[model samples]
Target chain A: MKAPDFSYFEAQNIEDAIKYKSEDDEAVILAGGQSLLPALNMRLSSPSCLIDISKINNLNEIKIEGDFINIGALATHSDVMNNDLVHEKLPCLVDILKMVAHAAIRNKGTHGGSIAYGDPAAELPAFAVAMNAEIVLSGLSGQRIVNAKDFYLGLFETDLKSDEILIAIRYPLLDVNQHLIFDEVCRRHGDYAMAGLMAKVELDQSKINNLDLVYFATGDKPNVGQNTAKLVIDDGYDYEKLKKSLASEIDFAGDLNSSSEMKLHLATILINKILNKLER
Target chain B: MSAKNSVNISFSVNGENFDDVTVPTRQHLADYLRSQGLTGTHLGCEQGACGACTIEMDGVAVRSCLVLASQANGSSITTVEGFDDEVMQKVKNNFLKHNAFQCGFCSPGMLMTTKEIISSKKKLSRDEIRSEISGNYCRCTGYQSIVDAIEETINEIN
Candidate 1:
């Protein structure tokens, strides 16, 4: 598998990377290159230039700022899984990370890279949306922050401009009362999830205080179960009604492996299972 | 913005340094290593599914097919041959005792991953060993033997 020819530029800093991208009409930013390289080799995308930002050391720190934990764009999935801050602050995110691809891939794949790729089936993007994490993008114009809900526009697409580079992601620390649960049904262990659900629920002594459900791999983008959430909270956490309401609210076109109706059914099953687990 | 179509890179492989080596920017690390007469790294699936191209980059296992040669410039890499003989001696003995392989296409990559698992020094169960080598596809053997071999090696180490 040979990739199309393209000029490569190793950027020293964020400014140089932005300048290189701004200059080229067909340019792609190289972060971990776990996703982009496979695309390049398969000829799915042909760019005139590749601005490699993997060398910039400044974009590789995982820090905590007050109430939020900041993760650098270049931080690998392995980094997130092993990072003490992520494990202590956001164990749900770490749980999702374990289900991603394989150990070797995670050792090289980056967190922001997967989110920027905007794969609807990817766990991180849906996880980001459920957590309402903030995505940081840097360009020649300076830095701009976009909420995770607004970051993903559609399938394999993001709000990032061509000349912009993703710098870091900011996730608010989980609250004491908040419980996050994630579940995904895939054909194989490492394969992309056929139907995945991640939710952050706040319970006030058995009464649902707040619930946010995000579904992936079943929609064009990560679909927030807003109406379903409202139905559950307003209806006093009725599981049966929630299942039926959720099945009707979320729509997905199944692929070769499963049917459209089956995908929705799997989503409902995953949701019910996760909610039931949370009750304990 | 002065990017080069083919760039010169410097990297160390198997304890040897190769500086000022020019390669196509689009070339992957697996292809580059093969070009340098290091065919131990197999290219099972360039799409990063099959882990036949697994290699050690800066002391961690990574899929070489997904990593570009240019991206690995100035880094230290280790292939199957770079793996120490002392460690592999025990793995090979356990593999033979368990009949770990058949066609041996996935051996080099499997060995590299197995090396990583052993070096981690974690007490691994059979299921955990199976999970660690899940990336490396072995069609010849039913993987039971492979898991047995790895499990026995872990036991020996502990």
Candidate 2:
């Protein structure tokens, strides 16, 4: 299906994008256009105008500042995956990004667009949650930061306002002691996961000190397995106990491809899989 | 087309320049390419799922169906028809030798993706080659021929 007719505006800068967004209530920000264009082509979303922010200068920079790795909103998936800084600072992200869509889509899909799209089945949103990344939103008033966990409201819903644009995301530099492990069950390599896990762990003498278990495609948004994480941290990797606890803690939502039972089963398998990897 | 619906875009397609051409804002790059008689860029699923409409924009492969014609303004596009390089020629020869495609519906996208994989210059294993071209779905030939073709192409180039 073809996209509905709309007006297009190429923003020269962040200010221009914000101004354009503020002027039209039905305006959408066009970043890499990987996700937005598909939605537009399918008519799932039909904005009156698109503020093309792809050409905005410096919005695609991936750099380290202070204690955080700041990924500019325009940074494409390929950009993040292939960056030297990202490879050095957040190597796990490179592995996780390889599983995103495909090479062609990755070349055009922006990190901010993926997060802003807030697909429950996507890897990046859950990654942001596990890493406790800070989302930067710019609007007419000023710029404000939101935690990745709070930024996502529900499936395909985000805290992004109509008049605001996601400018960047800041992920705190991973400590030398910390390790990030990610795994997902996709029928095919590039398809959205049936269920996925992004676990950030800091182990002290092989005991789980800090663990952040974030699951995708199991709930409306990236569901943090807080209770499950607590249980694992408290009791170690006891498969039976953790499985029981996970069943009670995480609420699985069934989609067209997988059932709630299947998601729960897959989530449990992923949890055990990561825990075993940590032990090794 | 009304002024509100149409956008003036200038882009280079297959080394040819199109200046100030008016296209509907909703028209996708694949459709626009086909309209220009570069029908090699096929469209299977308009959504991003099927990579049938994959093409090179600004030197990187992207799904043309997922990119609006307006969004492609000022960019350089290369379809399967655009390849005249030695590597692409070798790749084509390998596909022909291996019978990489059956109906050839997915051939354009497969070729574009194959070109990218070979150009990456990575020492990829058979599994990696399979993973890299996973987006382009070929309903015919069961993909073994495609994989074999890509493997031989890489070996020939190296």
Candidate 3:
């Protein structure tokens, strides 16, 4: 059953969407409706009006404008999967996205919606943070860009104002010599992750030049599990250290499927596993 | 949230525009489309779990049960019935040959899903087909034939 209604305005565009925002502080912007509908049905949110922003054309843009690839917040997971530009630019995103919900859910769930909802178990923000992506948000106040690393303030929290909507996400294209890997564990495919890793490492002369490993479903927040990255980035970085570090990484979340101790065990094992595999 | 102040909602379903009567604000797209007598889009496990009420809105497939009719206003929606064209014919033949469905409760969802995959024109591998349709559940068929059916449809279409 649908939730009780208030008012509805099919916003003509970004400007129109913003207009509806002014009338109702309680107005919720409806994009793909994948997250919003579920949130409303769960009674997690009660907005007086729904500002349907699906009509805002430019908000869905996904293209290469130069050094950075701009992924519009409205871009669906399928849009990420299907686009040659996305595939060409960020295959790690593609890998992570493949594990995000199902074809049906991914077909309509928007990039912006996921980031805004800021579910700690979500894949995009972690990927965004790992990629050093920049978030762009707009409201009646106008637009602003936020780095993904800084955007996530806490679990299910971001530096987003109620009136502002995420406009786009921009990330640098991977340099040719760079390598990227995305891996996550879930009891079932398309469900939220039990644990996820988005890693990008730049290697030179069999030593680490830049080692960035981000862990999600392993923290209260969706941002990088900094300790895991710190373990590998220090001097004398190696598979041996990474393995030991993974074991020691704090708060490896435990629940129904796996225990906190087990996640730590897996992280330790995988850090060595991934780093070793990166060698050959 | 009352009758005195009503909201008009409209969108396309199965290739036809439906400027339907005012429904309560909370009415889900799945229920609204179903009540309007488009039964091809079935309802099962009203939550996102079972892909029973799947529809393509704005060229993307999603669970109708999870969407508000108001949110879908002005968007082009294609339900299972809308797939009664060539793509589905290919899908149905492939399913029949492969014995893709037994209970058939999942058939409508399967058809809607396979139609999207087949229409994509991409060379989808067995794993890709399996992953793409992972959301739809079929207790009886056990998925081998379904996988074969989709793979067959993909090969034939592409």
Point to the candidate with the largest DockQ.
Answer: 1
- In terms of lDDT, the best-performing candidate is 2
Selected candidate, larger DockQ, 2 vs 3? 2
On residues A60-116, what C-alpha lDDT tens digit does candidate 2 reach at each position? 999999999999988999999989999999899999999999999999999998988
TM-score of each: 0.96, 0.96, 0.87
lDDT (tens digit, per residue) of candidate 3 on A79-138: 888889988888777877878888889878898888777777788877888888889988
- Which docking band does candidate 2 fall into? medium
- Model 2: colliding residue pairs: none
Please give the DockQ score of every candidate, comma-separated. Answer: 0.81, 0.61, 0.47
**Residue A81 displacement in candidate 2 (angstroms):** 1.2
Per-residue error (Å), model 2, residue A47: 1.7
Clash list (residue pairs), candidate 3:
none
lDDT preference between candidates 2 and 3, better one: 2
Docking class of 1: high
lDDT of 2 by residue, B1-158 (tens): 11256789899998999999999877888999999899999999898887899999999999999888888889999999998788888888888999887899999999999989988887789999989888998888459999999999888878
